[model samples]
Target: MITPLKAVLVGCGSMSRAWTAAAKDIPYLELTGFVDVVEDAARQRAAEYGSPTAVVSADLENTLDRTRPDIVFDCTVPEAHMPVTLTALHYGCHVLGEKPMADSLENARRMVAAASEAGRLYAVIQNRRYDPNIRRLKAFLDSGEIGPITTVHSDFFIGAHFGGFRDRMEHVLLLDMAIHTFDAARLLTGADPVSVYCKEWNPPGSWYEHGASAVAVFEMTGGIVYTYRGSWCAEGLPTTWESEWRFIGRQGSARWPGDERMQAQVVTESGGFLSTVRDAIIPPLPPGAKTGGHAGIIREFVQCIQAGTQPETICSDNIKSLAMVFAAVESAETGLPVSVSV
Candidate 1:
């Protein structure tokens, strides 16, 4: 019989709610306790989720001693991820942290090393890979139906006034939101980027000092070129997050027009080379197939911990996506392209 894994959550905010809900339903998972700096907040979250309200202490040692959970989930902000991860790993507990892993590349490197030394599973919440649409696309690319892939272009765009926390930041767009797009691009290509060139620009009436819209091009080791365009402050945009892709292969190409319910198109030629174009909408995931970002990510982390294997998408690879994001920032700052090695 499989034993239910105990979990303690830190940073009981909006994101934690999904984790809490998942814990209640998964037979092999249990939400043992909840902690946060704010007592009432922790108590309220625990009440909603039917978990214990441990004293929300700043010291992780104290929390671990009290909760003694097999897993510690760090749903904290970008800056808080490293300390929490290191502390949990030091105590011999598995950790699943929110994305970007850490605010800086140096911290991300240290976290990866720590996990390796401790022999514990450590991973980030990169939930996009499990999306039904993305999974279908991955299978298509792997099948070589369109021949050898040479280039990929993707876009993630949305317009919203984030007044709570996202807007009040120095590097607003890239650091705060573009990680998803960059990570998704890496997953799609199945290749690590060897170098990158990027540009960022803020409109005259933009609220953030840094550019809200940015573009980045990556050169992969196998000569695969990737181009990514993203924005978070485009006014009157009709989508929450519009995901589109253009994949070029030696024989044909595939395009994702950003509708989850519709089939994407794949075109391949049959003359000298097999040239064919067919409307193929990647099927959406079933209702219970893990749609919520944090929910899906946490479930995978638990599975990894129980199975004694690193999550296929670990921090080591995620650092590459982070590299792409920071490279864009660097390029934007210097008004020149920056090459990155991952």
Candidate 2:
């Protein structure tokens, strides 16, 4: 018989809602506790999720010791990821947490080393990786129908008026949001960043206290160049959260509007200034592709735990994505190209 893994969710904030809700759909997971700095917030989440028996507390270590959970869902802020992950791993629990692995690359590296020392699974909730469109697009790119990729471009424009901590944060766009687009770019290009040159600024009429828009150029491995232009305070005609993407390859090119209708074409005839091209069919998601976003990552993490395996968003790889984010920030600040690492 399969034994349900007991889980303690830390940081019962708005983000925790997704984690708790996902836990409910996985029969192999049981909510054992809720922990937040604000004790009432923990209790509120337990009640909100209908996990009446869940222990609620403000102290993470105390709850972990009491609940003796097998897994910890860290929905905490970026600053708390290390503590939450390290504490959970110390308790011999696997951890799955939100994106941008840590506030800094050093901390991310430390967390990775700690997870390795503890011999526990530590994965990030890079939910966009599980999105159906990205899966299908990545599959098509991998199929070699697009040939070897040479260049990539992505644009994210959203007029987010989020009146919260985000408005006051420094390098708001790069730190708070660009991780998704940068990570997605990595997934599509199948490469790690070699170096990045970026420029950031708070445009006129922007609500963010720091950088609200940025343009970054990345030299990716395999000689693929990836560029990103994004503006959180951009009003009207906003791109999807996934961002508009275009991939150019030796034989063809593919475009995803970051929404409905993705298109790809490969050259069929090698004549004339403009070679004749035919539509490259993007294959459907392979059987059993996880497409449930938050629930999908959570379910996969559970299955990996059950099967004694690791997930795609394991800390090691996710850290590379986080590295790109930090590199971009450094490049923007120094007005020069910066190499990415860790």
Best by TM-score: 2
Instruction: Give me the displacement of residue 232 in model 1, in angstroms.
Output: 1.6
TM-score of 2: 0.98
lDDT of 2 at 225: 95
lDDT per residue for candidate 2 within 183-273, as digits (tens), equals 8998888898999999999999998899999999999999899999999999999999999999999999999998657999999998799
- Model 1 TM-score relative to the real fold: 0.89
| 20-112: candidate 1 lDDT, tens digit per residue | 787776768876767776756667777888644444555567878887888888887788889889999998888887777888888888998
Error of 1 at 327 (Å): 1.8
What TM-score do all the candidates reach, one by one? 0.89, 0.98
